[model samples]
Target: MRFISEQRFDNGCLEREFTLGDIPGILWTPSSSPSPLILLGHPGGMNTMYPRLASRARRCAQNGIAAATIELPGRGERPRSAGAERARADLRRALAAGEPVDEIVDRLVIPLVDRAVPEWRSALDALLSLPDVRGPVGYSGGLIALGIRLAVIEPRIAAAGLFAGSFVPRCMFHEARRITIPLHVLLQWDDEANDRQSALDLFDAFGSREKTLHANMGGHMGVPEFAGDDAARFFARHLT
Candidate 1:
């Protein structure tokens, strides 16, 4: 309803703070009915207000849902934290001090995946603190989305909407299977992040009673206007 305010939460290692929008986002309910929330996480190079995310936020607002957009550390106004690059280097070193096969994927294989969960949880917490906040919430994006889903499986999040992302299903599959939340996945025909097969793999792994897969005929950023409306409809059915 009103611009609550914005605050910065550190990644625990960085002095530069990450910004979160608490005001002027999408809000459909009266801020008391416990509606589902939509939290956005941008790609490494993008921010919360990018066209794709902004458009969806507006649509969600029009449809009577609250929407918040988020940015990862160093991607928005901040730069990489001191020793962030070095910490990544150390993780690589630790992972490398093992067998050759495991060493190849090594540090990035798990630590990076492991680190993202908390960030999403923190963002969700911030979004839910508003007046009419509700239980079921969802996320969209690449590693950020996958990592968050991997961490917590709350049935309150009655549904999830994913676009162009997947995770290590083998390691995350058991937890992933626990997700009874309906899933709506969107993928571009020419997505370089793998292919439609990647989205299919995630969908099949989830085994939700309800699921929808859409293949749009566009490049990475060319999601149709219909997708936003579809997302609103899906969340409304499950969240409300």
Candidate 2:
């Protein structure tokens, strides 16, 4: 990984912007060394997601855990995917007609998982090579389907904190059944954009014996601060 820029948070956490191959990413390391790592996940768009991501990174730093995230394929400054764009247009039309979007959701989410998972694994390879980042890894945040695939395929990720606020392909339910690591899932009860029953069912599908669901009353962006604290504790329990 090539480090292009660096800065420090007021709390003494170090933030570095870097690139892995063509993918742009950011890494946050706390002032403390030998920190466990958390890989942050989000729905596409790095620029739009930065403020919240920075907040999450600061919290990870406070807890003495390193954190990092990469731009997903076809997001931000990356080349656009015309096929995904077409699938999105199809999704909008299907939604407009009150039609089931199973196929569209599959089309949109599956390929993203396929492409993004490898990039994250590659990022993991590079991040863990650094002296400051060590111990077990945890994954936290949205695009729950991608998180599921990563948790299943990437053995280094010891736990996960999933945000139930994204479209999940049905196939990922089977993949979810393969995940045996600890999981902490946060569901926004009244999220206008998410399917509540599907989120609950997906949670139930996880094969992890140690999974916990925190269903709170809010819109997608309105997760209570205490829930985040709870997730941090969960990671601390498993990763530290």
Candidate 3:
């Protein structure tokens, strides 16, 4: 990982922008050494998502935890894939027409999960090599499908906090059943882009012996501050 630029916050958290091959990413570290790490997940677009990601990272940093996130495939300055674009258009049209979007969601999300999970693992490999970004690692935020795949496959991630404001691919349901780590799923009850029942059923499908769901009444971006506080506490319980 080659760091491009960096800033030091008053709180003693160091934030750095870096690149992994062609993918761009950011890492935030507390002043303290050997801090536990949380991988911050988001929909896409670092410029659009930086405020929330930094907010969440600061929350973790204050608690002596490290945080990091990478741009998803075909987002930001990365080259776009034609298949993913077609899938996205199909998904938008289905959602706009108020038609069932299960198939479209499968097309849109499954490929993304396939492409992103490995990149995340590679990021973890590099991030963990740093002196301060230590385990046990936790993951937080959306896309929930990516979180589920990592929870199932990445043994280093001991817990997860997922934001369920996006469509989940059908095949991920099977993978969800394989996740045995602690999970804290956040759901916005009135999310326009998400199906409430689908979120509920996905929550039910997780095989984690220790799992909880927090549903609040709001839209996708309306996650309350207290929800983030609760998520930080959840990670602290498992990772700290």
* TM-score per candidate, chains pooled: 0.66, 0.97, 0.98
Give the whole-model CA lDDT for all candidates, comma-separated. Answer: 0.53, 0.93, 0.91
| Cα lDDT of model 1 by residue, 1-240, tens digit | 234444321211101123444212333233234556766555544445456665565555555565565445544454565444555466457546642322323333345445445555556666577556665666555452453354245333456777754334345545556566677777777864444664566667666678787778767666777876676687788766
Off by over 4 Å in 1: 1-35, 45-49, 78-109, 142-156, 165-170
Consecutive 10-residue window with the lowest summed lDDT within model 1: 8-17
RMSD (Cα, Å) of model 3: 0.9
> For residues 110-191, what per-residue lDDT tens digits would candidate 3 score against the true structure?
8888999999999999999988877899999888989999999999999999998888887889999999999999999999
Report residue 24 deviation for candidate 2 (angstroms). 0.2
Q: Comparing 2 and 3 by lDDT, which wins?
A: 2
lDDT of 2 at 130: 93
- Model 3: pairs clashing at backbone N, Cα or C within 3 Å: none
lDDT of 2: 0.93
